[model samples]
Target chain A: MIIGGGSVGLMISYYLLKKGVKSIVIERKYPGSGNTYKCATGIRASFTSKEHIALMKRSIELWSELRDELGVFYERSGYLWLLSREEDLRTFKTYVSFQNELGIPTKIIDLSEVKCLAPTIVIKDLLAAVYDPLAGKASPFDLILQSWRLLVEKGCKVLAGVEAKKILLSKKGILGVETSAGFIESSTVVLATAYDTVKLLEPLNISVPIEPVPKHAFITEAYRDLFKPLIIDWTTSSYIVQTPHGNFLVGSEIPERPSDKLLNRLEFLRKASKVWTKYFPWMKEAYLLRYWTGYYDMTPDHHPIIGPLDDLEGLYIAAGFSGHGFMMSPSVGEVIADWIAEGRPRVPEALNLSMSRFKKGKLIKEIAVFG
Target chain B: MDSEKVIVCRCEDVLLSDVLRAIERGYRDLESIKRLLRVGMGSCQGRHCLPIIARVLAKTTGLRIDELNYPSSRPPLMPIQLKYFVSDGNEG
Candidate 1:
């Protein structure tokens, strides 16, 4: 059984069903109504964390095949990280070499070469930059929006509008879950509820080390294609990407503020526009259309805590993706499915994301999250 | 007609296929693609080749002109104050 109907939940269900383990997914709201839909929809394998690099690599492989399988256009675009600070330059430089060592082929480019590569960008203040050509962006409208239907078609039972109250753990091996409607008996439970994971796992004494960070994003009206590629602009700390509908979607990292409130603040847009214009001066001509807020399932370290929680039998977690769950869900699903079927992860190295990492002080550091 | 061999990322001396293969290898996001292929990390900051890359991605993905990912943006990776260069003869 799986709790939460977001990207991670549905993806886990998908891989489980593929392995013949029919899963029942419970969602408090309709699928894609949460942060999964509000995500910036950037998928990439350029990461500093060794575990994420492996998982993202495998996840991206699945994403590539999923394009044809899902009948959706998971298109490829380059993610160019412009560096201005020596700190960022050094971080990216180390990441490039490390990524290359892992077959990622990331590299740092020079100033003259930067001009030749992306002339659309105004490079008057660039100090250095890192280039990863194998990154991409897909529309949540195209992928996550259709998750419920696709999941149903794939033989996973999705119980929408139903909330999992708590895990009904008894002597009977995680007896099942108590839901709003009634208790359903299941052998195992997988929590993919994002920030709500804390509440769901509270009964088991598992204090989910995650916080909900409110983030804001806005999109402009559909305009002619003026830009291509998802750019992480450090000066603005915003991720700028144009949606499939022609809207220029922009967002920035905000401090972690866990709350039930998800209101778009004018302050967010006001600052975000500064970054938008800083990168794309042409956006001034475009009109702002819509804006929304979502939460990032943040951990002490940016890396997510996947795998089973300590001392919890038949209970697993795939939460705390730190706002990057959508990009990594496919691989997370593959790994979890493998673990369930084989009593071990398909790749043992993935155990690095285990929740025990915090206790073991084995935290994996990641650098190429936004820039 | 040497478009294939023409430089896409001058920093890495990447060709067109180098950029396209970045996508094929599961680095579909623009940031990873650009960084991996060095398509837009050169001196011009993607000014010369980004449009070409965008056009190709749009065509390859069946996305309309508007459907492509927004072009990458970054602070100028250049134009550091000449004063910084004039700093106490440290290394240079």
Candidate 2:
């Protein structure tokens, strides 16, 4: 049984079905109605760590074959990480070298090259950029819907609008899950519930480092061929990508605030617009379309917690994705399923993703600006 | 009724009577009224409805209009068909 039918849960459900494991997904709200649907849908392989790079490589492969494997729309629009400082340029160059070693083709391009790559980008202060033609975007809602249909076809049950109140555990192991509507008997249970994981696991005394922080994004009125590629500027923690529809999908990190309120703060809009204008002056004239906020389940290391809990025998976790779960869901799902079915994951290093790190006080430190 | 006066969000179609009813319901803040009636979740996404909703909410709640916060915006800015979104073309 899977609690929370967001991208991770839904993807794991599909993979489990493919492996002939019957499963049921219980969601408090509708599937894809949570943080998954609110994602910026950025798929990128630019990471400072080996594990993240490998995970993203696997995810990118799956995404490329999604149309054939799952019959979903996946695009390869590429991503460009803009750097304005010498230190950032050096860091990106080191990362590019590591990526090249892993057979991931990433190039460190000059400002002129960056202009050629994305003409709409304001190249005045751009020192260098790491360009990966493999990175792109996809719709999380569509992917969830398609996966849900496939799960139904495979005879798996999905209960939407039903909340999993508690995990039924005995001395033997997890008996099943108790939901608002009823109970289901299962030996295995996975919590893929994103931001709510911390709250949900409070009863069990599992202290996850995850906190729900607000992130906001906006779209500009459609402009004719304004920008290409997902442009991420590290200085501002701002990312902008022109959708196929010609509207610029833009987002930036907001100052941390209390999590319960879903209201859009005007201060965030002003800050985001300022960043946009700094990056692309031409965008100043673009009409503001709409803005929305979503919760980011941030971890101390800015990496996701993906493995099982030592205290709970049958309860596994795939939450605390920081802000990058949407891009990593495909690989995370496959890895978790392999671990559950085969008794060990094909990626042995993924076992390090267990909650023991937090208990042992071993925090993985990386230079992540947006988390 | 004037075309501009049409209420799109049925939950908060603030007739004068509805305002009095909200006051009777003991709502004393614009935010409280919006929460109760969902005055801001329509297709216009609160763009055309919020000013009026705020006014009614303020009058009924016995609060200054400036005290009321603006309603938030939701995503999909302009809702398009799923097919159009999934298709590999540049049209929106």
Error of 2 at A73 (Å): 2.4
Candidate 2 on A1-371: residue-level lDDT in tens? 99988889988888787688979998776667678766887887767666777788889988877767776667887888888999888877887888889878889888888888777667787788888888888767457766876787778987776898887778888888778998888889999998778877887777778877778887665668765688888878888877655667778776676465766766666667677676676666666656777888888888889977787787889998888888898888999899888877666667767789887887765565452
- Model 2 superposed RMSD (Cα): 10.6
Model 2: pairs clashing at backbone N, Cα or C within 3 Å: none
Worst 10 residues of 2 chain B by lDDT: B79-88
- Candidate 1: where are CA atoms >4 Å away? A111-119, A254-261, B1-92
Can you tell me the DockQ of model 1? 0.02
Location of the lowest summed lDDT over 10 successive residues in candidate 2 chain A:
A362-371
* Cand. 1 Cα-lDDT: 0.72
lDDT of model 1, residue A357: 90
True-vs-predicted CA distance for residue A282, candidate 1, Å: 1.7
